[model samples]
Target chain A: MAATKDPRPCSIADALALVGEKYSLLVLREVCLGNGRFDQLVRNIGAPRDILATRLRRLVDAGILTKRAYSERPQRFEYRPTQAGLELEPVLMTLMAWGDRHLRKDDDRPMVIEHVCGNELAPVVTCRACGDPVRHEDLAAHPQVSGWTVSGPSAA
Target chain B: MAATKDPRPCSIADALALVGEKYSLLVLREVCLGNGRFDQLVRNIGAPRDILATRLRRLVDAGILTKRAYSERPQRFEYRPTQAGLELEPVLMTLMAWGDRHLRKDDDRPMVIEHVCGNELAPVVTCRACGDPVRHEDLAAHPQVSGWTVSGPSAA
Candidate 1:
């Protein structure tokens, strides 16, 4: 079945719609790691072939990834992240950091280390206006409803 | 079926394994927004009741959320984010930002705006060392295999 257009313009919801599937982010991880071929993604992500294929198509349609033919006659293609896909690095990085910190008991460094600085990165989201780390306790959130920001709890 | 244990100590993969189900993140989003009650989350997220219950239990088991009795007698409880769960705000914020920038086309603001800044929050994952925004093209990623940082391409 095809995905339907969203009725509301919500960022978190939209983001989930893009990468909420079981293996979507894993597939993106493989592509980000320069493993672009279908077989390579399947091997790395451990997804069923058909599920991987469907995710690839959805990601391509979503503009997060692009497909390019690497070989002719036999028709082999490689998937590469677009500029949009590249921007999702923070999400992936933060998730990794969170997992390493909370979920796993890893003494070793986590996967995907940054080369710019030799330090293992711990991502913190800061407020752009006042330069404070955004925390749920400190901030009061207002959800937008009917073109106005309404004060209430919202996730969708 | 039970979720399989990951052999590797990769944080990102482990994190995904915890929350990669269809409605898990959505459920987390609900809790993050302070919608603690079951009916409230159900109303906001629109997941099946059974699925939402399962997601909630998984989240609690993963220590991302905690359940506390809010009402007496009948035994009603509310879910709240732990320190680890609160740390996931960055992931949720980045996903929201990504969705707004790439997925949706509404001229209005996309999601829950922090009351601290009147401006819409734009979360950027910056290097802890240099304070520059991390980008995929700028990052040279290395995968951790057998406790070694092997070089590869990364988004940030």
Candidate 2:
């Protein structure tokens, strides 16, 4: 059987299609971190100004962010996370935790998130129903597409 | 501080620097899903062959994946996740869950993950110290870099 010609219609794929562009999530990082002004994003993300503008526009169009006027004289605007964008914070946290574990020394971590629980935040993905930390081996995927399986496209 | 001339060094930024390319995470997605061969990846990810090859090489070089000879006669190789790569599964799961909640109808989700605990997996990010599901408002960011705050660079 040939592998399916199309990528599986997946929400992960969909999410990536929206936010996977270079510098896009970094833009989210800046905004979510409360640095949302254009100049601040340009400085904090190191994305070229034009590219940063484009990303901000795309995010706003996708409803992940909103722009609000923050200055009156020059009409300066700032970005803010919409609900959808705020919810992605965990994804960013997990990614950061991974990088902290594998790429940085504990003392070299660039920033730390302190959860309201009073400890430095280490994000863990858990099963909502079971409250157990998720592990790769303990999960089984069921492709909801017509002709695909967890392994690949089903034989025609 | 004039917006601090440098982007705040961040592990999230470091992680994004490594896997922030267009198809890198999707490549990881396929490998994690057990479709690790070249043809399988090509079919499953729909990335151009050459681009996919570059991504595979980069992933292997980054130690997120390993290339192992799977067939001797034709010298075929398959990719497998390293420990670091498996740790990224939660990020993917969370991204998928976000997309499912925001972008797709419940019945329209293209896949479901079944946790070993006999429930459909709904990945939730929780605080490791407190076991509470993380919320945007409940977290605080502390920028470790000098002259930076959650809002922006401090005035020098």
Candidate 3:
């Protein structure tokens, strides 16, 4: 089936639509972590050949990734992130942290991501207005009439 | 075609696979903003009717969102985020900030999101290790052979 046209109300939706498949984010994450070969992504992601090919093509089309012919002998190709793709690192990290926290068991750490500064990484969300970290209780939504009409909950 | 299997190497991939369709994130975003009704999502998202129905069903199946019959006359339904869905707010906010920064023109602000304290909002990412805001330069990936193998430029 043809992919749906991206709904652009929010950039998150646009980004997700572009890379929201089962293997897409993993492919991007692999690329972000420096994996670029088609074989490497297939191996790491453990996806079927056709599915991997489609996801890679879509990433390249979206400017999140680019492929270069590495060798003509075996028809080899390598993938790399474009600037747009690199910008997605934070999002990837945030998702990783969420998954680790919510899904993974306490004893079994899936993978460890660290900074160059020799510190174990944690994902943090900061408030733009006060420049302080935002907790769940710290943020609330202000609704416009359009927002209110659509939303079922009263503004907190 | 059958949907691709969930790529298990990363949690982000899992999350995206579950609710990563064209209108899924947008619908989730609207729900985060308190917009829940069927007509409201249709107005906000502009997605196809069948696709929207499918996406909603998938989200409900995955426990990210729940559907309730809000009205009887026209058989209206309202979508609400479960805790799982509410947990996605940060991810959505992060994507919105990225879009505003990269996609919007300098003169055209698409929309303003305000925090409960009546402050205009901007989203920020910080390092979990140092308690300092993370910049592009602060992150680095170590080449571990066991994880996804990377073959691109060191950073991108």
Candidate 4:
């Protein structure tokens, strides 16, 4: 990791602050898949119970999820995704796609996605303006809102 | 996180296994931003020296980055992204967008992306099948390849 003299804000850092922990997004993933109960999350996520609780509270605080009562007698709560949480579907999808492409030995994708019509699907990221598949070559990143200086290995 | 009774493959888990740690992606971010030297990465990422070294080696082993001899006098090397590393541009872009939208205070976005035409851009993830933004409602995730039971909050 390189040190930057400029203390400009970095979005990657902010996003990581939200979900970069090893098990944070996994918790959210479980919630996204509708496993909102604490016990269910504990079993599936394989994270410590306390850590799971903390991540849940953090996600709620981050406005990505909301907690609602599912049972009154036991005071059980079910976590649900807010609009912001739902927006993370793409990030999860892309992560899954990358994993499917690079990591798995067998076609044993843990979760298989499909449409009601029984059509298997893969999602792609594209440009809103051009409707073209977004690629590294097609875009350049500026560290700040302005002043586009070329950096990275490609520049070499 | 939900426990899966069925031991199917999970791409997200696989991907997370590679880069889900708190500082792993940060290291990658610094590298992606062209801060490949050890001292540069350490300063910018604020990660421990040993951890950064370990991550750089792991990234090299993962085929995401390659090490090249940059200087012979002192035996210095530069880390460069391979094809796989470059493919992560979209992921970084999306992360930046999320941060800018939800995390930043004064719009100090770490990375600003622009098209060749100088049009500021936000990458959108969509499905290739329908040319539509793949939202949670548009699809369903099955625990297994054969079984297609809908199990998510949106199902209700």
Arrange candidates by DockQ, highest first: which order? 2, 4, 1, 3
Best by DockQ: 2
lDDT of 1 by residue, B1-156 (tens): 322323234677788888888777766776776677887676666677898899999999988889988778999988888788888877888787788788767655545566366655667777776666777655666666543222264232
Candidate that beats the other on TM-score, 1 or 4, i.e. the better one: 4
Q: Give one digit per residue, the lDDT tens place, for model 3 in B41-85.
A: 776778778888889899899788898877889788878888777
Clashes found in each candidate (C-alpha, N, C closer than 3 A): 2, 2, 4, 16
Note the residue pairs that clash in candidate 1: B136-B155, B136-B156
lDDT of 2 by residue, B1-156 (tens): 455677878888899888888889988888888888999888888899999999899999999999988789989988988989989999999999999998886568888989999999999999999999999888889977777768732221
Query: Which candidate comes out best when scored by lDDT?
Result: 2
Interface RMSD of each: 4.0, 2.9, 4.5, 2.7
Candidate 3 clash figure, as a count: 4
For each candidate, report its DockQ versus the true two-chain complex. 0.49, 0.64, 0.37, 0.58
Residue pairs whose backbone atoms clash in candidate 2: B1-B155, B1-B156
Candidate 4 residue spans exceeding 4 A from truth:
A1-8, A115-118, A145-152, B1-9, B105-108, B145-150, B154-156
- TM-scores of chain A across the candidates, in order, are 0.82, 0.92, 0.80, 0.87
Model 2 alpha-carbon drift over 4 Å, by segment: A1-4, A152-156, B1-3, B152-156
| Model 3: residue B144 alpha-carbon error in angstroms | 10
TM-score result, candidate 2: 0.94
lDDT of 2 by residue, A1-156 (tens): 644588767888899989999889888888888898999888888889998888889999999999988788988888899999999989999999999999986578889999998999999999999999999888889987667756741221
